[model samples]
Target: MGIKSFQGARKHQQAGEEIPLKVSDYMTTKLITFKPDQSVEEVIDSLINNKISGGPVVNDKNELVGIISEGDCIKHISDSRYYNMPMDDDRIENRMVKNVETIDGNMNIFDAANKFLNEKRRRFPIVEAGKLVGQISQKDILKATMKLKSQNWKK
Candidate 1:
């Protein structure tokens, strides 16, 4: 989506024609976070159990550190086979993407959607005070759109 469409959405909201949705409004607050020192097997298990493709990696203090994904796990497995190493020997810190992109909870839904389109990221950790507060995904944006479509607006 372009900035013009997003601006139009904001205008629609300002004119009381549509609901103004924010990232915090639809973001998944109950997040499944991982630690940098955690084992790759545990990360895979967490991803499977949580029914998510990836999760943020946080320190003990709950600070946003990195991100781990299914792709990262697969690469770990591949590297292990090539290097004759064991899967359990690797840690999330070794495989996780340290340079991460994050979003603010108060950001508009359209802006978040635009980021998803441009950045090509599956999910983003929502930060408050540099700490992980929640996560938003493309699916979440779709859900917000569905919610908006279901609403009966006043003329």
Candidate 2:
């Protein structure tokens, strides 16, 4: 006689039934945004107060214009010392990265992770209808992974 199996039959998941993990689900919606006219000194203050590396720069209409980070502020400070110029005179528009790359909210976390690795970026802004909706960081991806630790990752 064949040996009897003790374990119950495994359940198969239906196609498209399991919801994919998306970037929007883990992105931070309430962001500490900056303006182009703001001073580098102010940006430094906000970064320190919030304990963040950088923030998105937006216009009066809440449109993403650029991004400013600690690195940018540091460069501004260095230039100020070299040029013998006051630090307060420098504006974010001068130091901010105008060409910003954004990520789609609907993208799966795995694809987002690969993009992050390829881009070497700490965070990416999520835009909808040309408006800054949220931002996702490496830490957020880590959090998502931890949340799904018990589940198997789909290929």
Candidate 3:
């Protein structure tokens, strides 16, 4: 006199390998870069045309040397008027931030997001062997999050 089982047999779920999300996978490979000798006016034009806040400055070897932003361009314009110097005379080398911070391409997306939050930076350049490879922005992190919305977040 055993009780009858009404429910069907439970299906066994297979454990699948989870892939680690890396910054390089979500970073932008093609970038709008600037040269040290380029004029601030030209940088400003590129920034406006591209609708970007800033860009990286590289050397002849494509090595990251600095970063130039809208703030720098504005400062150059202000300084030009104050010093009575022509805006055309200003160079990216003088206006760009020389001591630039970069991030690794293999870093986890969560770690990269944390870095962006801690550093208060909109984007971080990815470098390998002293050469600029790509860049990851906050928007890219957001896109990654959206893409992984169904997956569990792991460290």
Candidate 4:
């Protein structure tokens, strides 16, 4: 059992000679985006219906504007009796959130990990040249972690 050869660790080859693993590979491509004018209730329902915890928020031009989380809805729930109450037609423009954290699809997993682990972000909205594309989450990062470890084990 000299140095316990890594022969068996080749099973988790997430990347190979012909294919390279990327954030986009693991990210949720079919993103469920939100409009700033979208009601908090609507976002909450979307999160539940899609079985996702968060997503990117985009404007009418499909530009990334903000990122909304399930926790945001939970906090907003304390603001009113009916959490689903639609936004006031007149206030719709002002109701949509704008501050959101985003990342590029080509960013390495290590950088993504550092951003999420060292920063205050619960998730990252995947963006491309100012356009909302998809989203990467803590769950997605965890998956990358396992995959990276498995691949390195064979080195």
Q: Name the best candidate (by lDDT).
A: 2
- Give the per-residue lDDT of model 2 (tens digit) for 55-122: 99999989999999999999998999999999988889999999999999998998999999999999
Full ranking by lDDT: 2, 3, 1, 4
lDDT of 3 by residue, 24-112 (tens): 99999999999999999999999999999998999999999999999999999999999999999878999999999998999999999
Off by over 4 Å in 4: 1-8, 11-19, 81-97, 153-155
Q: In model 1, which regions exceed 4 Å deviation?
A: 1-18, 150-155
- Model 1 clash pairs are none
RMSD of each: 6.9, 4.5, 6.5, 4.3
What lDDT tens digits, residue by residue, belong to model 1 across residues 3-67? 55432332234444546578999999898899899999999998898788999999998999999
Looking at model 2, which ten-residue stretch has the lowest summed lDDT? Answer: 7-16
Candidate 1: lDDT of 134?
A: 92
- Alpha carbon RMSD to native, model 3: 6.5
> Backbone clashes in each candidate structure, one number apiece?
0, 0, 0, 1
